[model samples]
Target: MPSTPGAGQSVPGTAVPGPGPAWFGAVMGTGGLSTLLQLHADAVPGFATGAVVMLVLGWVMLIGLGSGFARSVARDPQEWSRSVRDATMVPLWGMVSMGLLAVGSATFVVTEARAPSLASVAFGVDAALWGAGTVLGLATALGFAVWLISRRPAHPLPTWALPMVPPMVSATAGGVIARQVKSEAIRSILVGACVVCFVVALVLGVAVIVLAYHHAWFRTPVPVALSTTTWIPLGIIGQSAAAAQVLSGPSLAGLARVYSAVVLVAGAGLGAYAVFVTVRGFVARMPFNTGWWAMAYPLSTCGLGSYFLGWQWASLLTVAVLIAIWLLCAVASVRAIAAPRHA
Candidate 1:
């Protein structure tokens, strides 16, 4: 068998180079954007208009950019089996993501631009669609986790990371109930679900990034591989947005905002780190690879970070940042497609 990255010297019968963690990470990473977008619209009244526009723009950036690299990486004949699975599922999630963008954007649009009744209908539909998408997304995450743990030979990573499924599912359920059921009696129930899912997701995302960082920084002898660290900003940005929504409670909200401040500040620090990494990459003249997509992910996180900060100027700035990323992704997609394959 060909040697795989992180291949098991861990156990017999265990498969090496399982796609589970990577796949799960991708799905959850996508949701980080989805939920954060919604949270932005929800928290900032009247800002929904801008939120919808930016959300669509961000979606375009992610899909167009992600598809490009996914295609490049999938082209390797050695990657055939994994590529097949990823290709099929990616499109499925893409459709779902697009549907989500559409519904979510429309929710904000109709709510703001149209009649209250119209907005209500849109919200109802949005709830259903968001709930279903959330559930499916969570399932995908769980599936990835399962795939990770199934390595007949054990990998050192914990199987619980795979359990990101439950939080996603719970969150979706909360969204659904919050939308569909009008009863105040159920409001508390739904709220609990939403909070649980969101909280669990936040913690898990942070955990993954931290673990990846530890592995890359401390465990590995080599300079921490940049690819593994790219997604850290996503969690940092996401946690900030989640923190903003928690502000409804005196104790919780106060604490949440404080926590969010820490994340925002950390996000700034990481943003600097990313720039340093990029400049270093340029100076070192690292070999070109699809891995450059890592740069864009952090940029997107920066956009999300700005969105979470909720300042009028900050949100607008983030939209501008998102637009820039969107443009970069478009260019990258074209290059990735036109360039000849080399591994």
Candidate 2:
């Protein structure tokens, strides 16, 4: 079931893209775009931006991130240890599950506002996709959750890490419910899932701000500043914000805008840092080796967030930038694959 051919072919998961870091970009990208689409649909009449964004994000995930990971695995089958393989596989399914939700959501949106005739069929298709995707994603996540619990991190656990599990579990539960439900039940379950995703994202938000502060206080700039790690979490935070907006409706309009603004600000600030790093680092004769491209993960995250947080102009800008970065990363990864193994 893994999409990446080379990654999971020989090994049960070799052709399957590693769910671990490979998922970080796709998950955050799709989620953020969906969130923004939902938000725009509510605030403006006949807004098509969200739908387009979702489609584009989906395509990018499949082509750029998915293919990139596949190549990475193909280069070295042993890189994906059994433990890491399990960890990555869970999220790969999670992405599939999310894709189903997206189709369903899009169907509902289009039917309600645009064409009633297409509604029934699309809705049904949505259900089927969501169901299939959910089953796969859930099985993977559950398996990984068990694996994670049994295993220990290399160092002492951070306080913030503790809260991550509950929200994640809650979101997965919501995915299951969303896939199985019908009528009014579907909306209710999705709303719940969005809430959990946002909660998880909020915790992540706090962590990012903390990291930014830590760097500032220590006067030691963390390297890979512009790469995917720093800005992508904000994108997830933005998606959660947009999801909260959609679920809550007009009654929470003010709160929704505030959340969106916060996401936009966070994204912009982090994006600036990334840009500064890229420029400064490049001009100072810093190596732009294959390793530097890894930042594409976080850059994609920030780009996704930019689009989702109602920052339309910025979102478009980031998407373009992220696409370029992603391509560069892909080339680099593939080159690494062709390079002779040192050992």
Candidate 3:
């Protein structure tokens, strides 16, 4: 997933010549920022415009990055299998589905304009992307689980949770599409699918996170390069909260509220710790890699839960933190492009 050459002794996720799936993190993160800004649109009207711009940016990134990755796969079909076998890079496969889901969900929130003329088109687009993302997400989750069990990775990396989080992304994204679907029968099916996806993601993510924490504590210190992934757990936590909150209307409101409340409390604490570690790593000169983009979606997802819970301040605070990280990542990604060795 790194921007390095295909053949290299650098870290597994360090770099490759063509665009890797991890590059889709740009789209995933941009969509997250757009959604977070939209959450603050009520308090700051100007944020709505920014949200639209972010959505457009995400779309552009999806197109460019998707093409590049597709090209790489076409040119060298073995690269896909190579990446799958590379433990460090395998987790990034989840980003491919999640990136698509990000744009799909944001299409409704930011790009739709909510005009009557656009509803049908937006619905079609969201449904198509949601279907594609959800299916791909399921495959990624299963594929990663298979790899984990058979290979039995000797040490746990926080990025190990990356592959498990896409189903949660699917769950939350499906809730958005459910809102747009007109038929009650179809909506019910979507809701059920969301719940199922949430459970799959949460259960699998918990196992990975536990192992990651255990490794972080009882094993050796996490590499400075991988420090950002320490924050990856927050991605599932916040996404689960958002999925529950979004399900409140169609499901049990009180139960959903209570679940979201508990997850939010946990997210607040974990998020604080994640931010500290990220800053420490940055101060210690963590080089710019595709891994740096790892922080964006997880941090931005915390805002989703906060906004859904009507915690305006908490949501906006996440936006502030995400903005800072985004600025650094934006600059670093460009630098990485200019010099892959730095990646």
Which prediction has the highest lDDT against the true structure?
Answer: 3
How would you encode candidate 2's per-residue C-alpha lDDT over 1-343 as one tens digit per residue?
Answer: 2222121112321222333333433433343344334435655554356555555555465456546656766787765464246453343344444444544445455444456777667566655655564455445545544554576322211111212322332343244345445667766768665465556445654553555546543655534322222333333444444454444556877886686677667566656764665566556644233224334434433443454445667655655565566556556444544453532
Q: Local error of candidate 3 at 302, Å? A: 0.6
Off by over 4 Å in 3: 1-17, 84-88, 114-116, 249-251, 340-343
Prediction 3 TM-score vs. true: 0.91
Error of 2 at 279 (Å): 3.8
Using all chains and alpha carbons, the TM-scores for the candidates as numbered come to 0.58, 0.54, 0.91
lDDT of each: 0.44, 0.45, 0.79
Rate residue 184 of model 3 by lDDT: 99
- lDDT by residue (tens digit), candidate 3, 169-195: 899889988887789999999999999
RMSD vs true structure, all candidates: 8.4, 8.3, 3.0
Tens-digit lDDT track for model 1 on 129-235?
A: 55665565555454544454454322222122223323433453344346456787776676765676666556655565455445544664223333323433443
Clashes of 2: 16
Candidate order by decreasing TM-score = 3, 1, 2
- Candidate 1, clashing residue pairs? 13-153, 14-152, 14-153
After TM-score superposition, the amount by which residue 250's alpha carbon in candidate 1 deviates from its true location, in angstroms, is 4.6
